[model samples]
Target: MRWFGFGFNAFGQIYVHDKLIKGECSDAVKQVKVISPTELASHVDRSDCCLKTDGQIRASWSRRASLHLGGDSCVCLGGFGAVIASESCGISMKETPGCKDAFISELYLTLAFPDRIESWDLQKKEKTPSWSMEIKTESSGPPLNLPLVPGGYIATKPPFYRPLSPQLKAKSLALSAEHAILLSASGAVYTWGLGSHGQLGHGDLTSEEQPRAVEALWGMPMSCVATGGWHSVCISDGGDLYVWGWNESGQLGLPSRGLRKAPQQQSSQQAATGDLYTWGWGDYGQLGHQTLISSDEPQLVEFFREQQMRVVDVVCGAWNTFAAVVKEEVACS
Candidate 1:
């Protein structure tokens, strides 16, 4: 699991095995090992549930497991509890890392969580598992089958690992469709459902089915947070980047691309001005600001700040947005 890379690959996405043509910039950090041949690999333990979380999934290796199991099991499924994603196929969940186990999914009708959670699955495996029901868990785990299509989502995703809590430590989470944006451990940034489209930033649009607390990002500590179906993002460990909701299409690379019902616009997360920041929706630009327009607030994406580069990371797709920049011109002689 030691893979390093460098940038621009005219369609290889940045692949340079023997270097037949990786296209651009292998200027350094090159070491991409590959062995290939995985059997049923598909596990997501809260790598933001597979789209937006911490990390962990370096080399799952388990056509049927034998020598690549990072025990302590595996936690961090959806965040704040309860998860079972699997749109169709690609499943691999079984890591009860911390405790409070019991997930049971397949046809729905078995979801009971009082606390102590952690789960996975999202896509592939829907033969006839119908009959939906949420809120049932007392201690169950044998009657399973739902691995990717119950509320887990998967158009394409891979990478997860989050759930270590030294003391309420969550860090980030952002599910969006109805609403969700949690960030624990001390950065504070919770939210609930159906905020009409303000995306629960709390400026308005109303609707707090639970979760609460986004009181203007309260105390500003946020390490990272993302959600874009309406809008809501966070990144203030000094990196700044605090967006709001629904921009129509500019996706929050704001300057105002319409859809401003007047409410969520508080700004001032403070410090470190530019690294990455997008908005609600950007027709196709996905808020990268190439065009397509659709913004609400938080905007700043100068193609990685015109090349000085620093964007540590950021991912959002309900419309498209992904960043991971690095080169601040790193030299050395």
Candidate 2:
């Protein structure tokens, strides 16, 4: 159960202390914490918080608001100031949605939410966090991290794949500042969350709070999907690319500041899809076009075809567009 801390030095969040009284970690030391895992376990909840980087205060186990520990509480779990342990006979964790947006390292399981994240130790040969008692908290934030675990690689766990929708198989996912989109295995597209710019592809400007299938592209199996700062893009199986949402930076691969006329809503056709299209926020040349003109519609990038090349894949970051392609022989060759 060794914990290795390596990252930027802007913060002292990874510092560990040897003096353990069952409380907060001290950042007075400049070295990484290792050699022992018990002290780390007792203070793991404190390690995950970035807000308390000063590290001067020690957490008391006696606080009524804190989790009650029992003799079996050799293992501890904490996140976002809330903690529940095997010794805490009052807590049960079965009802909450399991942790997503997290990473499982060799010795630690880091569950990251939007603002903060916490880590739980995986006890391979030690005491496991008992799940018999359900854990409850006063906070309304979504509780994450399910199934107290033993030390092992995340890949070795018993199959944990659960379907979001029994009928729809998700093929790909993309997220913007406040919205997200999902593509189904069968090529049906679903978009939800802040739809002010028509990023949801529902044909009008409105936000969606839940997953809604994009009716405009029904039956057209999408091979690829991508998103940037405020826009979204998807490629159909027929080698055509579609763009939507905020185009302030030409992210949609268009030439001006207006949305392209969406084609008449037609059912999808079964065709191979491949191509790179970008729109929205092209001030950084993210659209991949040679110029810096912003666009509101889908435009084909001619650089690849003009040079006898074929695109394998394309990805857009906050301000840049990257593509992977296979080069084709030109007539001169």
Candidate 3:
């Protein structure tokens, strides 16, 4: 398997062979911005054991984490070309065998276990989690779940929890910088919060104080939904993809005449045949187009296709992108 990365690398966040000293070199000499797709070393420890993403790839502003080997191991990378072992951060997948996933951020590393999600603060010396949220394992739970709020969805302070809107049983939830989206069990899509960029998919740029069903997508039976900085995308049951919201950089895969770029906003997809495509903000080469030119339309990332590599999965970061790829097997008659 191989991995490819591109975009802002000022801190070596996307992985570079040499260690980067912030102030030691000029901006041009630093080679901080990668304007094309480049191969990233598979082994973070420089060892024979290559990093694997058997499960998922999660990213933060300046770091990336890959969970592999049935979640038994987690490999983390930062801008300085250092690999942080899970054990070093008091995260032992072996001890907590139930750990199924993880989330990374600028200040926290969260682990999702069977019953709860624990968050550890990177700035603190202690390895204990500063906070955690309980995850209901069973399909049945308190009827009233979280409700959409101004900046995000909220559950009342713990110990004295208050559940609101019991009727809305969301099967999946996604949160952007300023809005929230939910997919109900019936496959209906609901959105709320900031709508200045029309991310709510309500056909208007009006903010919603409460969860509002996206009428445009009514009866479509969306199977999956995702939100970016200020845009939204969802896949219908029939495999049709729907997109809305800010298209400044053409993140929505729609025609955009204006060049009002929205940094860190982009979209990507892996085709059924294993091809990968990216579009939107490319100022930092996040689009993997080999050029620092933003595209309003989806462009095929030919590197993988040219090398006979099939992209199995893809994940986008704040300013970069990562793809999990494998060599395609050839048949001899």
Question: Which model scores highest in TM-score?
Answer: 3
| Residue-level lDDT tens digits of model 3 in 298-324 | 778887777888988787887888787
For candidate 2, lDDT tens digit of each residue in 1-333?
122121111112222233222344365233321211111223444432221211111111111111112221112233212332423222223311232333332233333233333443343422332212223332643333322111111221223222255455555565454676777668888887788887888989998877898888887788877655467789999989888887655556565535444442332433223444544544434455555555555555555555555656443323334344555645864
TM-score of each model, paired residue for residue? 0.24, 0.41, 0.79
lDDT of each: 0.43, 0.43, 0.67
Please identify which of the two predictions, 1 or 3, would achieve the higher lDDT against the true structure: 3
Clashes of 2: 27
**CA RMSD of each candidate after superposition:** 18.9, 16.7, 5.9
Runs in model 2 with CA error above 4 Å?
A: 1-163, 258-280, 287-311, 325-333
Write candidate 1's Cα lDDT for 1-333 as tens digits: 211122221112122223323233363224221112111112222232332222222111110111122333333322111222322132233423332222222212111123322233323243422222243432533321112122232111222222222343344455554576777768888877788878888888989866778888788888867666677778888987888876665556665536665666565544254466655554445456555555666666555566566656443323333354446765879
Pairing residues by index, what is the TM-score of model 2? 0.41
Ranking by TM-score: 3, 2, 1
Query: Candidate 2 — worst ten consecutive residues by lDDT sum?
Result: 53-62
Model 1 weakest 10-residue run by lDDT: 58-67
